[model samples]
Target chain A: MSASIYLDHAATAPLAPGVAEVMHDVLVGAPGNPLSQHAEGRAACAHIDAAAEKVAGLIGAEPREIVWTSGATESSNLALRGVAEFIGAGARIVSVVTEHPATRDTLSALAKQGVTVDWLEVDAHGAIDHDALAAAVAQGPDLVSIMQVNNETGVIHDVPAIAEQCAAAGVALHVDAAQSLGRLPIDVSATPIALMSLSAHKIGGPKGIGALYVRRRAPKIGVAAQIIGGGQQRGLRAGTLPTHQIAGFGAAAAQAARHGIASQPEWARLRERLWQGMAPLGGLLRNGRPETAAAPFLSVSVTGVHGAALITGLNEGEPALAVSTGAACSAAKGESSHVVRAMGRSPREAAATIRFSLGPGVDEVAIDAAAQRFRDEVRRLRTLAEAA
Target chain B: MNRGAADDAIRARFLRPTYAVDADAVDAWPASGAADTPGEDARCRVFLAVGNDGRLKAAFAAFGPPVVIACADWICERVTAQTVEITHTVTLADVEKALALTPTQRYAGLLAIDALSNAVINLGQ
Candidate 1:
């Protein structure tokens, strides 16, 4: 009867009320563009600057370092290009096999453009081997990109250790901390990260707005203004900043700073509840590590499950329960996750996989209900399938 | 035990006699879902199974001529002219529960729907 038990936080989080209210004020009242020179414009600009400062405080970066973009996809692009081109890093970028498609495909595109690409491999646990990182950086590429927390696996990489390696090699590092910033502690001052990408929607902020932290010194990756206009955001990303969304993102960021630590425990408890519920089922297999992995997302695959059918069935049978079998970006066509495949799961195992992601709103009761419904459905369907 | 992907996709929707499906599509199934090739003889019966990606998973039915009770989504390891014992179950759970029923050495396509634990396994020939 109420809102559905939303477990797919990694897909997109529900906006916080605090963020919503702030955004409402800006959208309803703010008139002139933040870029306009009029008093109205200056008022809007002040609102944007304040919002950026709040976001900067959470990540321990200067407000001047933050440049806004449409969202993570663009933020990621800006980081990769703005640094790579600015340094003219010889078109070769070093990274790992588990990078999100944003970085992976971007590198792949660069590879086609004669950029040398080197990738560090991860073990079954999704941990990057230090030896592999050393090897990938040995040749000295223009830039290296790594995501702080994996979206699907939730595996936390040693970004600082990685930063040290990049620093030693004199390679610029770009950390796609979209999943990490809100849930995990990030101190850009300590970490040798040159460029970092942040998305508002991922942290229960408004959708459309994301930011990039570009260190003035190591600005090698030059993105030739994908949206050239009034040269806003250090001229790297130029457009009329969505003041309302920025205000919402700032509110979300502030809320994230306040309640961030709660996310991990909330997810960990639900995840444990899920594993306990699934223990009796002989065929189920856990996908990745929780604490080391992304705490909010849990992927499990039963020995003989069809992932697409399972997701659809879960959505249909338990209206309050929502889940996914593969990457939400690739959900429309029923393609299995390449991220899982990189972890060495067979296609069948990958197909059987279901991603049970937890959000801030999810509680033990919701977890139990969803798990019970899932088990009941699974048992019923399997029994019937056996009968069929 | 379960409807084969072929059965699930075709069912009543695409099986009309006048349904304009490509002959190549018709050609994929030489001997499944019906008894005998379209023109071959009453002795030859069709078998239906889900095709994972490309190859057939298991034989589910042989409806034309009604030669014995059709075992759905089975490989029909033994298909004689008069009787076709569906050697395996169509769905995965029945296949697992009827473990003694299935031969130990056989390749099959097994996929469990995530929404439910019950698996849909198709034994390939």
Candidate 2:
């Protein structure tokens, strides 16, 4: 079939129809720059503000707390770097090695600049050790960044617990929450995070647009503003924001806030069917605790088979299927995900792992069919290997 | 084949696009279908049989009992204007065991809403 089964939701999700319609309407009706002093411009600005409010509402914050950025990378950088400069001085930043490259590299650079950094150890399941975080925060660091979810393994972290530790230390918590914002709940009141990243693409909004949740009255975690421009995003981010992207991102955030749980049942059902299908095959290992894992993702490793080959085999069928070996952004590098590595997997097993992510187009029928395809492909590939 | 015979002997099964399936039609065909026959050609489990640009785009596996495992495909007769989505590959043995039909019956064995010409057809080219 020409269509591949789409199981790559972690990389980016297909735009939901609701988000698409809103974007299309805004694109056609209001093409004005949101900052211009005209009726159309005012209308555009209103649309953007409403969208921002929608995004803020999802995380239980006021609209003004949301500062738009390019996407997860910029949002992440803004939160971490923003905190560093806002404090008007340097301090320690504790993060995990399992974090996305955005946070991982950000902290790495911070370390080079002599920022005290604590790269916490994770259990085999990729959970951040709370005691480690508590100890690190107890050191009186000014800023700490952690993700609400592990991108590759879909492991949910204890953001609230970590935030509590940071609060006790009078430290500001910056949650790279790009992965967990819509897939799971993230009420700022519950986590009380000083800074959190949000991405529209992850919630079916267009790419290149994200925002940071900056709490009012948050303790100063001064960060140097990287880009100097029109000072558009409340001096947090500068440059004329793309109205279309901002509008779309806001629209998607609103939708996620409203109906995020509606599409969840299908994912749970699909995962159950897939779990049953894959459980029978020997040498098959499911990576995370399903209950704690994200609804749409299931990372698994079949002994004696390369995850990439397995993906190819599954997609090579009718009702075309799609799957992935690891994070799409980093898959081309041919390295197993660092998140998987943090879970204590041997390099070979980690390399052989495949991630099956479902989204709007997926259902139990597709997943069950895919599970069979997965088994069939794994059997064929392993048999060939043994024969060779 | 007359309408009565076609109706009584064969019926088309409706499957989803690349839908999963397992039926009780494995008695009519030989043990190892095309791929495992150990004949001139070694069979493939699943891969693209036709380019996507073609009318019939799909992938499949030929297992024992002449079964077929395939992504969903449309089976249709232009004249009849009848179309059915073929989700799973039915094995020959499955046809025999499930329907208890013989080859002589022709279209009476494995017929769906789509085709009448090709009976016991596994994967489309």
Candidate 3:
């Protein structure tokens, strides 16, 4: 079997080295439910608590303020539903069109439950309209939710600016940091964000574990519980904590802190290398501004080529180039990416976009291979197109 | 997306699609047909070039998912060099069977048939 160069880090990054060992240690060493009052249970609870601290440390939040959930999707649902339920009906919620489906679908459900919904517009470059957002904020909306980094486009919103606006407006802010959690430095205490959603899988940790940072000090926030059972997590979330997964997540978090946004420059250089390598092939259009986007992700749409065809072709080749046509959810749905559509791209462009998200251990040779593979596929498909 | 549902043949055709189209041979035929369809969230255009002797040269342009593209390539390969009247005898089931399309990919077969039927209609034979 030929080795593949994976470029779908936005979907789910591979587990970091040593993370599996940490998880295995916990799985074998601590096998009791965290809820039990026995010594074994206490040992399990200690693992859970240490994991919580690690996750909190990554975002500069108090461990007491973090609530664990199944992953970013559940964290999103819990954050949105919990807050919406707390604020009650007739409250207004504002969010951008480029949010992940977790937040987008939850907001749609909130709309159905009698909360008014207003969508913030994004420009062609995928930047949120600051003036429009300020005006919306002035309308006295109860909550504002925006993603820190767009999953498909890698566009980074001005979270601190948005947080300040929401704070001045007396509106609670929820930042979906799934894409930005490990890639960016997020001090929840300094950002004025009331709630933030984070995922472990996106940061070289295990899947099926995530956390929500609820501001507990200044601008203290409370959320109604979405899942109920043993009244764990102070009633915010309830279940027997997965110590193994939490341990992996904690180890991942600790590892992430050692670098803490220092690798961004290298990531940007590698992204540029791929882009430049393919630019000479022509018909390349970037989906988001590189200056504002996350360093590791480069989303480009090609003219005169089918996006899905390119994706499949790249993956099927020798030394396969594994990338994404869009976000993981929409890619499976076999639909044009909504993030590209929201950026004012034509339906054809939306269908032709490919997201190249890099990760650790991806060297220049792999980037060149990916670029060459992309060029070959585009040429092949375009020749077929012209003939047709 | 889990593409494991598709057989290796279909998967290979979708990936490399060696039978997609030939640039020099497309415009030289005397009779031709074409069809357009809205696929999933994209569009597909299938074209055929027919010789005076009634044989076909098939080519397709698609912006849809892998299933639709592969289906076009599969049908084009099957129909090329066959008599122009073959479109009348061809069934959606034939194309689906040839591609080993999964249930989710069944619509791609319909699309292929639609395009092939339209190409035959455009032949005006």
Candidate 4:
């Protein structure tokens, strides 16, 4: 058997070059609490500050706006739950039905706590209807929370347009940019986005480290800290920050700034090549609007094959294909993708969906091999189904 | 479902189901019976041919998780050279034990038994 090919970068990307070295240096060399008054503490604080600058630079934000958190999940929790708490009960938040569970579940919890949530629906292509969004904004909700990119289908939401509507309505817009932070060019200064959740692991940084960008400019945003003990991070997120993880995140962000922007077209081309290779199978359906999808993502749902059987065959085949049936977080639930189901596909079709997300090292050769393995698995499963 | 959670027996059988009938040869079988669990999409079909000495030859085709496929293949391998009456006597426990199926995978065993029972009935008619 040949080596396995990894296409599940959406789940977690491998650490990029320079990220591990910085992390190692910080782990071995920097050994003081960032908030302590000692010299070592001051040195640690400087590292954290530099990392924040790099993270801020990637998204065109001031370093002061970045509030470090555990990861995107925590950042989202801080963004949504904190915003809801700040606005108090009876606050209204408008968000899409297909936001990541971090946002969706947080909103659900808030709804139970007396906040009214209006979940905007998406069309079959996983694209939100602008009119529906406009209507939601017209209601003057306190906040409009949406994701910049769909984790399951790679669908890119027009966050700028959404932000425009929210800004005009005098509403705060919180974007879960876990999937978009480095993969896409984001200028928070150019857009009126009030709050954004970001994760480092998704962009080849260390896991368990992320940031929530709280606008410090006009329409300043504030979130009541969910994790509070120490009065660190200006009391917004209170914890002794992980110095090495933060340093690694900054290095990853720097690398993304240096390479991620220029690599978009190449990634998009590879994605297209992958799709074209698998398109000949006839019953395969692309889950999102290709023109609007992120460059690294390609999600397809196959017909005429049992979803479970297909996944098994691909995983067990020689040179196993490392892909996901949906979001890795939800795959273990053994249920169809809610994101795909929300887009109007039946449960079975949603179950059959495969999300192939590319990363930095993936090339055309890997894409072709993955496509061939995908086709072979689908054909094999279809043949078995026909025999039955 | 957690594919790695499957036992080695199930993994081996699922990866290379030796008793699975080829799609082209499915039409040439003397008698075949298929059963599917409606909402779960767990399905199994058993194909049988009576040998010259009144014994049975069996092959299976399945559409479901690896457990279901492995269960169906196990059932076929168990009943291949047995008499039709013996095939009818194959129980759910028999299939479950052979595959080391868990409680969650009990449906695979049931589906296999149902398919084989139907095949036995069809062979009689």
Candidate 5:
């Protein structure tokens, strides 16, 4: 009861086992810049290369295709903006309305700069309609940007099918795999994704480090460099590489490749357990179809309770449950979830939604404790409402 | 007041709203007054009652952010067990001062005082 139960993994997961140690070793042992030609620099470059290979291995990409950036936000900005800049004015990009703000805001900025964008609407369950997507693709946009998974609802997009559609249409597809990297299998070789944005923290790697995979194969995708100076990462990104952070990211990716995929069924089981524990409350609305969502995520909106009060009660109660009402980025603004609203939920329902994203170290005990806390807070708030 | 500090004050009051009324206890009070500000996004209702001895008691139901709920809770606690005349004297300033409500939350104090005024008027009638 003293320790808080963490279920906000969609916001960021705890660092995987040995990731911190790997980072510590790199920080203490590697002191030279990777760009320098000295022996020390060569040593540093070797670490970066090794880390790159590990990360590339996870998604079936070559080490040369990985471009490191500052987490997924920067990766997304670089990918989308770079493409928009390369395509010049009048370039149209198709994406879903429910994408993370990193993608959405970047697209909005691109739109302001004269790039046309077609924002596809999602259905009530937060899944994009295939016919609408096909229609949009047939219109011949220069690029298609869609998240492999919705950060807020965990709704899995049919990326392989979408990739096929885009490929047939001669459109380059960019998938934001930030939330889906470890939770789902992604093979660039198997799927025709032209560009992919990845975040380390989402998969138990350190924060402040992410990667963008730019395909080097046939059809030859082109992306203009958004960050200038130092001419690093083939001038795609210029800042000096963070060796320790990259090392940690690599370790996390290695761990996920070795263990995370095999752990999905257990994650799924725990997610269902959590849902069942809270289901008896009777007025719960699952935000998206569970079958269509990633196994580690469950979002539910409560009826008969003040949204803010319910969040407060759960967060402040004994055995505090760490959960989010929406995307963690938007939660700080105290705004209702745009994702849920886009899914046709009323603002009130969106506000009352809680996203419980499980990751490493989450167990049945944690799930049951979180469920008990959720029930207690919902009942208390509902009773308080009834009395009033 | 700093927004974080104000939020902290509101959170403290919101987590333990001791004077919050329960539905089962409504029948025991003799005199009652209620007011509500209705909206799609933010809604609040305050219910006030006077004891047989003319002492005031209050409770509230709100569908708003923490600041509004905390304001109502603060007003109820401030006026509880006071004479009806004293309870009626509670003002927007008093609630605001107690809760350190932000400017956006100032409406909550006004809503609380309106409910209290209505209760006092009901008791007089």
Candidate 6:
């Protein structure tokens, strides 16, 4: 990492070391269509298959279960739309208000088309009410969609327990695991989840590749294909696969598998150190419960400070602390966070909230510096507010 | 079109806020007006203590994005020492041009106009 602190890993991580090398190799060495019958085409197909297996291994899934798409957005779109199309309209889907835009908006669109979308309410700490979810599932919805980890607050959802509920209710569970895939371990075989969405860029891979895991075993999910050009990936998604992107994603996933889980303790310590450094700023309120939130994340909202100014201050100062006001997409739109608002925060508190997501190479020194920068900026803005 | 501290003028004004309302001194202002622009989640309140000669001494308080606060600060600088009539003529376009605000930041300009217009109206009362 450079001297500037990059604490927005959930938005996107810097590419892992070997990722560039692998992508370059694929781009230069084997530039052939994977669908062709030639030797070069066979080699390209092997490259894609290897990438599929690596991604599958990361989630403890079968290689055949993975369907490649552009990114998490596409994966989520396919997972939600495909199921809705297959089950037909009038089928009910249960979800939460805190889902990423890809899932939330897709669910909304489905709702517009006569699919009943039951939005589950979250508590003040951003946790979904499990009893509510179970009750929704008991109503025999066709699918239950929720994220494995919240992108804004880093609140980790209890997906395994929810998956068990869905299984008992005979309802399909679709998890958007874009934020949790590499940072946390997910064993598909262990959990009774029916589908999942995974992203490459969020885990240090290339931006354009992602996967949707469709369970092919005993309760086979017969999803209709959203894209229909060339019948690639068993007619689920159709297009010429980009070998370079897939190879980069595979390289990133392999490295994350090696280090992501193992580095959690260090990340947790850094997160705590960051809180300690900023705790003296008396108005700081941690957004999520530390016990339940992911270790790489430290989300807080400062009272008596404008959120936009705080973000701008951090982003513009010396050694700019690259954090987020919320998800990158929502921030770009200049809209308040739906996730924060859903958790019952006032618009001001939601606007003032900052999400700091840590990753590899963000050490103790960086954490301390970032925390101090946050403290100084909040104090400066508070002074400005008071003076105003 | 939010200008950060990288813009030296915005940085200086935002950090110094030379004409910001000191909370303790707010009660002493003879006339005050406030406007809330709900669309942008911005609020701007302008307090004035007019001189005996009718020259205005303007102070402002605002809450919202940095751009809004910076715009309020810039407005305070521009409107101070001017006649009440001139303060009313401080258009939204003028604030936009003076601050180099972007298309998305036009709301801040509107907010500045509302607060200054309200303050000028209060001077009559």
Say which candidate scores most in DockQ: 4
Report the lDDT tens digits of candidate 4 across residue range B3-98: 454576787788788898888888788898889986567788999999999888999888887788889888998988888778857899887666
C-alpha-based local distance difference test score of model 5: 0.84
Report the C-alpha lDDT of model 6 over A1-388, residue by residue, as the tens digit.
Answer: 4539999898899998889999999999889999889999998988988998899999999999999999999999998899999999577899999999999999999988999999999999999999999888888888899999999999999999998888887888899999998888899988888889999998899999999999988455668899998899999999999999999998998988998788888888889999999998898878889989998988887788777778878886766899888742223244768888888776677778899999977888889889888888887777656634
TM for candidate 2 is 0.72
Best-to-worst ranking by TM-score: 4, 5, 3, 6, 1, 2
Best candidate per lDDT, number? 4
Stretches off by above 4 angstroms in model 4 are A1-3, A327-334, B1-6
For candidate 6, the per-residue lDDT at A263 reads 85
lDDT of 1 by residue, A1-388 (tens): 1436677777788888678888888887886799899998998898899988989988888899898988888888877665556556467788888888889888787677666788877887778888877877887777789999888767789887898888888878889998887888888877777888899998889888899888765533455556677777777787788999999999998888888756677777778897787668778867667668767778776654445435555665544467766653222233567667677776556666677777777788888888787887566434323322
Predicted complexes: DockQ each:
0.04, 0.02, 0.43, 0.54, 0.46, 0.34
lDDT of 6: 0.85
Poorly placed runs, candidate 5 (over 4 Å): A1-3, A327-335, B1-6, B38-40
Top TM-score: which candidate number? 4
Q: What DockQ was computed for model 6? A: 0.34
For each of the candidates, give the backbone clash count. 44, 39, 0, 0, 0, 0
Candidate number with the higher TM-score (2 or 5): 5
Q: Give the CA lDDT, 0 to 100, for residue A69 in model 4.
A: 94
Alpha-carbon runs more than 4 Å astray in model 3: A1-3, A327-334, B1-6, B25-31, B39-64, B79-88, B102-125
Task: Give model 4's TM-score versus the native structure.
Answer: 0.96
Candidate with more favorable, higher DockQ: 2 or 6:
6
lDDT at A218, model 4? 71
How does residue A149 of candidate 3 score in lDDT?
A: 96
Model 4 docking category = medium
Cα error of candidate 2 at position A14, Å: 1.3
